[model samples]
Target: MRSLIVTEFMSLDGVIDSPGGGSYPHAGWTFKDVQMDEAAYDIKGREQQEAGAMLIGRVSYDEFAPVWPTMEEFAEYNAMPKYVVSTTLTDPQWHNTTVLRSLDEVAELKQGEGGPILVHGSATLAQGLAAAGLVDRYHLLVFPLLLGGGRRLFATEVADKQRLTLAEHATYRNGVQLAVYDVLR
Candidate 1:
């Protein structure tokens, strides 16, 4: 079975919204609020290199599909197979893109043959996958600041407790921390 990895740039208070600038009030906080060294982004590069396919929710797919393909840094992601979980999305313009209707399809995808399906900027989708016990791993880049209010990676009300084991961790000079955890089944 393939691994499903959810990666995010989160705040100290567990806020995962608008790290790269969106409609949120604290948009672009990841770069605007923190002035981290280039090394801090090495983890992102590694994720792109290691990921075999990319999976995202409709919102993230809409946000990324327009720009990532043109950017040279996101070439790996642009080239990889992209799956967007959406019930409304009928046509996807991005190359090698597929729209999945539900989390069950995502679960099926995880069982198929492939490398890790890296998920980026899909808070709702991640939460659903986590609650459904479909997520296999998580790569979180936790920033030092806290926004206090925003959508979080983990939901407040969970039906059951999910256990996770810390696989690796690293702290950057700018106080950004990388926490890699494997979801225990």
Candidate 2:
């Protein structure tokens, strides 16, 4: 079975809102108010470049499709298989992408043979996968800041039950911290 890895840029307060630009009001609050370096950006860039596939929520897909595809650096992501989990989006403007309408579709995708299935900014999808017991691993970048509001990466209901086993830890010269973990069932 292929490993489903969910990667998130989260705050200490568990806000996974927006880390990119001012597209989200709650976003940038954590990263801007605090002074923190972006650790292992190069390493992340390399990993992104080598990624085989990317899975994202509808909102995230809309936000990323227009920008990342235009970037010269994200060519690998553009060329690779991209899956978007959405109920409302009837047509995907992005090339090399497929929209998944049901949770079962996601499960079937995971059953297929492949490299790591990278999930980025799909909070709802991540939660659903977590609830369905589908997530195999988590690659989290916890920035040092707190945004009081935004779409949370972890569900409030799942706070007590879900436990993670740390498999790897790395910190860069920048304040950013990276931790990889597996969900302890």
Candidate 3:
């Protein structure tokens, strides 16, 4: 079975909304205030390469697909397999993408094939994945600031708690802490 890894750029308070731009109030909190160094980039690059495929929720796919494909720096990530969980999204604009219409479809994909499937910036999807008991690892990039009101990374429903072991922890120049945990149930 393919391992499911959840990755997100969250705030100190666990807010994971609109880290991309200023369309929302939570936007620009991490980038405007924080500085990313080469060492941090290298670590992120290495983690990105290790995953066989990327899985995301509809909102995150919409936010990332447009930018990453055109950005030359993220060419490797652009070409990797992408699985999007969406019920209402009729057509996915991004290339090399597949959409999951139902919970059953996601289950099938999780059990299907390939290496670890890394999920990025999809809180709802992550919650669903967690509820389904599919996630194998949790990789979080926690920023210093806290957005007082916004969507959170955690799910409202109580999930079957899985024991997690710390895999790695690193601090970036900008005070962004990277925490990687392996699910040990």
Candidate 4:
């Protein structure tokens, strides 16, 4: 079975919204507040290299589909098969993209042949997957500052508690920390 990994650029307060600048008032907080060095993004590069496929929510797919295909840095992601969870999305314009209607489809995808499937910037999808106990691991880049209010990584109303084991961790000079955890099954 393939592992489903959720990756996010999160804040100290667990806010995962608008890290790359969107409609949020505190948009672009990740680049603005943190004094990031090249090393701070090493994990991101490694994720791209290691990921066998990409999974995202409709919102994240909308955000990334138009841009990632044009960037050299995101070539790996562009080339990999991508699955977007959406009930409304009819046709996807991005290459190698497939629309999955529910989490059951995602679970089925996990059971199929593949390596680790990485989830990026799909906050709602990640939350759903976590709550459903479908997420196998998390790769979080925790920034030092807090936005006070925004969409968070963890949901408050999850039915059960998830136990995690720290697989790896690293602190960058910019005060950004990489925390990799494996969800205990």
Task: Please provide TM-scores, in order, for all candidate models, with all chains considered together.
Answer: 0.98, 0.89, 0.90, 0.98
lDDT (Cα, tens digit) per residue for candidate 3, span 37-109 = 6665565687677878888888888888778888987776788888888887877878889888866777787
lDDT string, candidate 2, 1-185, tens digits: 77788888788888888787646786665456656564545546755765678899898898899899889878788888999999998888888899999879888998898777889986899998888888888888877776778788889887447778999888766566788899888
Q: Which lDDT tens digits does candidate 4 get at residues 1-185?
A: 99999999999999999899899889999888888689889988998898999999999999998888999999999999999999999999999999999999999999999789999887789999998889999999999987889898998677898999999999999999999999998
Give lDDT: candidate 4, residue 168. Answer: 95
Residue 178 displacement in candidate 3 (angstroms): 1.3
Please report how far candidate 3 places residue 146 from its true position, in Å.
1.9
- After superposing candidate 4, which stretches have Cα over 4 Å from the reference? none
**Superposing all C-alpha atoms, what RMSD in Å does each candidate have to the true structure?**
0.8, 2.2, 1.8, 0.8
Better lDDT candidate (1, 2): 1
109 Cα displacement, candidate 4 (Å): 0.3
**Alpha carbon deviation, residue 20, candidate 3 (Å):** 2.2
Q: Which ten residues in a row have the lowest lDDT in candidate 1?
A: 35-44
- Candidate 1 lDDT, 1-185, residue by residue in tens: 99999999999999999898789999999999998678878888998998889999999999999989999999999999999999999999999999999999999999899789998988899999998889999999999998999999998888889899999999998899999999988
